[model samples]
Target: MSGSDSDRESAKNEAIRIIATDTASVLKFYGALEPSPGEEPLPPAEIVTPEWALFRWVQVQLLMSLDVFFRYRGRVPEASALTHCWYEKIEHDFLDAEYLVLGVLEGAFATFERKLQAYWQMLRPDGVLMS
Candidate 1:
């Protein structure tokens, strides 16, 4: 692998780490992560990995489907709604990265954060491009 490719992998793995950790923390807060019916809790490292992140990603999707059904009763969205924008961007970029790791975080947020940053800096405050 090339230098840039290795960097992309590192970024994806880091994203996996973050998503897994956050999902577990949220579940634990609600006692949903606890083992049931005499089952043993998973090991620390086992719960936070690429595989677990993917699992939780799917799990979240299922929960969202449930929300779609349940939200009608409350007439409001769930406060626990999770967005997949981060997971999606990282996963796609990991398959074929067009930029460095830093670029993933910068560009994939709503798909235009860096574009705004690139041009916003040129604004003269009079709505004119610097050039």
Candidate 2:
């Protein structure tokens, strides 16, 4: 191949190498969260941490959909269609029929950081102790 063609091929190979290295580093970071026997297990889901982050980011889109629907609440057709789409995505993706609704609520139990802190503090008279 000509020198120019060889240079382009070399650059493409370097880009692939960089991407593979980055992916390996990310996988290593997530591997740290893996639990051992006798340890409290992580949540069992098909989604990984990165995937979950991406999935939860959809909440922003969900919020926008809800906002538009509320803004045009008097217009039944448009509002209904938006609401339907919102429910469809949430119910299908986040809270599917296979998973109990209570499981979702249980996940939300950790949403209140301060409340969790208070609850843990109650367990220790000194208010702070290493587990």
Candidate 3:
């Protein structure tokens, strides 16, 4: 393959990796709750520090994004970036599933920045989380 082709393939692989990771990270809510006793619910999934909240957020986003695909019969605009022609140099009607993958991936990553922000404050001031 050409250089550009190689780069495109690399990017596609990376996107697939991230999409699988985020979707698979969706955790089940079977654990018991144990709040810090006084303060309002916090992250780590509104409980304490279980990494569950972030996963739940991603899961919800994935579900909401998929709702469009399953419920709307995939009626997206021709100008949409995530469509049959997205990942190809030449557009055709062969297996346009990459659009759904891209959508779900976008939804799954929506919580990344929020997750960072949720923990950002911990890196400063009161040092509540600082050891």
Error of 3 at 20 (Å): 17
Error (Å) of candidate 1 at residue 88 is: 28
Tell me each candidate's TM-score.
0.24, 0.20, 0.23
Candidate 1 lDDT at 78 equals 46
Descending-TM-score candidate ranking: 1, 3, 2
lDDT of 3 by residue, 21-66 (tens): 4333333332234457797653443342223444434433443444
- Model 1's lDDT to the true fold? 0.38
Question: How far off is model 3, as Cα RMSD?
Answer: 17.5
In model 1, state the lDDT of residue 61: 37
**1-131, model 1: which lDDT tens digit per residue?**
23575675575445434432455543443344456788987545445542344343333333333333332432433456535764564365343222222222232322334523332222112232222
lDDT, model 3, position 69: 43
In model 2, pairs of residues that clash are: none
**For each candidate, what is the lDDT?**
0.38, 0.37, 0.36
